[model samples]
Target: MYLEKLSLTNFKNYEDGRYVFGRQINVIVGPNGSGKTNLLDAVYFLALSKSAFQNQDAFSILHGADYFIIDGIFEENEHSGHPNRVNPDRVQITISLQRGQRKVIMADKKPYERISEHIGRFPVVLIAPNDTDLVREHSEDRRHFFDGVLSQLDPNYLRDFLMYQQVLKQRNSLLKLFAERNQVDNDMLDTYDVPLLDLGQKIHDRRKQFVEEFLPGFREHYAYLSNESEMVNIVYESEVSDPNFAEEFRHFRRRDTILQRTTMGVHKDDYSFLIGGVYGEAVPLKKFGSQGQQKTFVIALKLAQFDTLEAEKGVKPILLLDDIFDKLDDRRISKLIQQMEEGAFGQLFITDARPERTRELLSSVKADVRFYETGV
Candidate 1:
């Protein structure tokens, strides 16, 4: 699947704009703050139904606008021997948001009852400078990255994962109420525990299995990017790993009641990043890896995500590279270009401040390439 065109209105810094993209490569060139990154975020929004850079949808609207709209046309051809794919047709996706109202997503002019359904239909992998937060920031960030990957790969996981988060929020609210009232109701709390435990366990199992399956590919990409400079490891850490999660949940009721929030379960799960030293001793990458190492680590993670999504979905996902030329080394950039030459990536959207440099670098790539100057 590839996005053939994108149109945005009152989105971030863009007032009214429409862009046509090449099926192979589309390079977005402009100066700093020229909305280059915002353009990439728009593509990310279409794929995942959310802005990658901003936490609030309202922030995506222009300064004076109270609403925003993003529309895209996708080409879906899941078969072979065809220039487009197996089925050569167009799919239209429209996302609109108004002030103080919920966002609406429509595919082919039909609105989705649940936005989660839109995911995986157009899988995409985004590599940005902020991705280093996966290694440097809290575990929630790491969990979100992995959960997003799994949700795109498995709709069942998305359904259960959304349900789990909803249950977790309600459970936390109840805990807050209990603490305020100074009352302990194990019976009422047990009501929430049943589904929490059931779904939490399943989520945990899926995450554990995903990490195991993902690590091999992650390691391979890291090796290729880092030139086998170091060994890397990703370890899944979760209370669900304990077979006695239910018992532990019961044991922590008083604490949960007092704390007014959940202190256990899959929601608190994390993936630990480890880097092997020259002598082979594994240590936390956040604490031991250098700045270059951290950048390399996150880039490898995204590339591995690309490979996994392509392998599982049987379609190459659209890749969004946001100012990556400034963040990655030449060797790593060459590796990415090499992958593009090898036809490892589908449609690509890349943002760069230097158009001449981008042109010189991509001169070796054998694909249909187009360039657009933004914020001009």
Candidate 2:
């Protein structure tokens, strides 16, 4: 499936904007600070139900506007001859957010009971310049990235993840209340602990399995990007891996009470990126890898994400490349362009600051390319 049309109302700098996109490669070119990234983010928001850059939905609304709306029309290829088709060939998805209110997502004018239901319906993968932060930043970044992929690929995982977050929040609140009242309600805390442990274990197991299944593609892509110069590995670490995690969790109750939060769980898990050292031992990529190697590592991770989603969903997702031309060197850019020439991607969107340079770089690509010049 591909996004055929996109309409933005009071989104970021766009007061009212609409675009008809090509099914292949569509390049958005404009000067810096001209809403080029914001335009691409509108598509990302429509597909994923939130802004890629901003954590708050309200920040996406145009200045002086009370709300923002992002609407898109996605069309399936005519030759996709899969049975058991319940929806139509085309679907309209609309996401709107009003200040201080819950975001709403509707498909074909029908609202879903829960936002989680809308996820994974139109999976998407985005490669951005800040992706290197996955390696250099804290463990929360890595956890969030992997968890997002898993959530999009598995509905059961998404359900359990959402429930786990809810229960954890309630549990933390209870801990705070106990500190305020100077009393520990062991029985009351047990109510939240039971499901939290169960869901945490389930999430941990799925994450371990995902890392194993995901490593092959990740390593293969890294090899292609790095030209087999070095080996790369991801180590999934979690406290839940302890044989007596349940007992340890119970033991941490006193500490959790003092801390006023749940400290040990899948939420605290981390994925370590390791690259082959000079002597063949794996070393931390964040500490030892060069800038080029770090870039390649994150790019490889995103490409692997694309491969896994396509394989799981049986449909190529919409790929968004945000200012990657500015971030990647010529060799890396050539590799991506070669992929475009080889028809390895479907319905791609790229943003560039220089229109002439974009044309020059993509000149050799044989696929259908349409350019949208912004800040005119």
Candidate 3:
């Protein structure tokens, strides 16, 4: 699949915009606050039905724009290694926001119900400047990022993921209510627990399997990036310390009553970063690594995520690099650009203000790179 064109209406910084995209490469370049990030956000919103930068739909709309819409024309390939089949003409999405109105998503100009169908079909892997937050911040963020990427590839995993999250939401809401009234909502408790245990267990199992298979590929990229054999840690921290989730549930029942919340299960699960934990290293990457090492490893993780998704889905995901070159120096930037030029990606979109910086790094590579100015 490929993006033929991108159309936007009343989106951030672009009241109306249309751009024909390169089948393999699209570069949006301009000075600071020139809608570079907003353009990337448009692509992301088209693919995921939400902004990659914000948690709220209102935040994605332009300050004064009443509504926003994005449209993309995708061409499908009917011929593959296997026998040929009919291809989808196109899949278009429209995201809208109006005052006192709820956001609605339409597919092919029609109301889209099962949005998940669009996920892996038009997959994407994004690397923003702030992605280092995966290492610098809490473990929960890392877990969510990796799991979300994996879920986008496997619908069964996604089912388990969403089920656990829904159960967690209902459970937390019940706990909040109980805390307010100082009474156990036993009905609410039962309502979420039965499915919670099942879904949580599946989620844990899927994560465990995903990490085990993904670590090698991720580590390979890390070594290639930093030339370090520190064996950067990729641990899958399970929510249930023991296999007996049922027993853990009972043990936490008393605490649940006291705190008015179910404390045990996948809801609280997190994956920690520690090299010495398993490899008996001098020190874990997170603890002793320099800024350079951390950034290299994070980029490696994103690449590995792309590989894992491609291997599982048999389709290379569209890559989005949000100012990834800003943090790295000349040498590192050159090496990374070399890899990217060697067909490390299929379709890519990158944003940055420094055209000279991008030029210096990619001087040897001939691509469909173009420079365009954007501003509010």
Candidate 4:
């Protein structure tokens, strides 16, 4: 599927805007502050039902504006062989959020009973300049990246994950109440603990299985991007993997109450990146790898995500590249360009500050190319 058109109102830095995109390569050219990234984000929001860069929906709203709307038309290819086709030709998805109100997502003018239902219907992969944050940032970042991928690939995983997060939040709130009153209520805590443990185990199992399935594509992409100079791997770590996890979870209740939070669960899981030269023992990529290696590692991760989503969804995902040309070196850029020329990806949206540089880089690609200039 490809995003054919996008319309934005009151979104970040976009008071009002509309764009018609090509099915192959569409380049968005503009200066740094010209809303180029905002346009790409509008597509991401429409596909995923949330902004990629913002934690809260309200943060995506334009300053001084109380609401924001992102609307898009996704077209399906007839040759895709997709089994699930609600609408044969095109689907219109609209998402709107108002200040202090719940965000709403609608497909073809009908609102979904739950926003989760809309996810994975149209999957997207984004490669941003900051994706290396997955390597340098906290464990939460790594978990979030993997969770997002699994969520889009399997709705059941998304459901369990959402339920797990809700339970975790409610349990933390209860712990805080217990701390405030200086009372321990084991019975009340059990109410939240039972379901939390069940969901945590399910999430942990699915995550572990996904990592195993995901590693092959990840390593393959890295080899291509880095010319097989080094080997890279991701290790999934979680306390929930322990056979005694249930007992330990119960044992931590007192400490959890004192701290006013859930101390241990699947919520604290992490994916550690390891890198090493051929025939050498791998070490932490964050500490030992060079800047170029770190960037290649993250890019490979994203490319792997794109491949996995396409394999599961039976349709190539819409690829979003935010300031991608500015971040990669010539060799890496050439590798990506080769993929573009070889039809390794589907619909692509790229942002670049310099129109001339974008033109020069993509000149060799033989496909329908459309260029949109922002801040004109």
| Per-model CA lDDT versus the true structure | 0.90, 0.92, 0.75, 0.93
The C-alpha TM-scores of every prediction are 0.96, 0.97, 0.91, 0.97
**Tens digit per residue, CA lDDT, model 4, 128-246:** 99999999999999999999999998989999999999999999999999999999899999999999999999999999999999999999999999999988999999999899999
On a 0 to 100 scale, what is the lDDT of residue 238 in model 3? 68
| Backbone clashes in model 4 | 0
Clash pairs of candidate 1?
77-86, 79-86
The sequence of per-residue lDDT tens digits that candidate 3 reaches over residues 240-269 is: 657676777966765776776677877677
CA RMSD of all predictions: 2.3, 1.7, 2.6, 1.5
Estimate the lDDT of model 2: 0.92
| Candidate 4 stretches greater than 4 Å from native | 77-87
> Would you give me the overall lDDT of model 3?
0.75
Best by lDDT: 4
Give the runs in model 1 whose Cα sits over 4 Å from its true position.
79-86, 277-279
| Best of the two (1, 3) by lDDT | 1
Comparison by TM-score, 3 against 4, better one: 4
Instruction: State in Å the error of residue 306, model 1.
Output: 0.3
Q: What overall lDDT, based on C-alpha atoms, would model 1 receive against the true structure?
A: 0.90
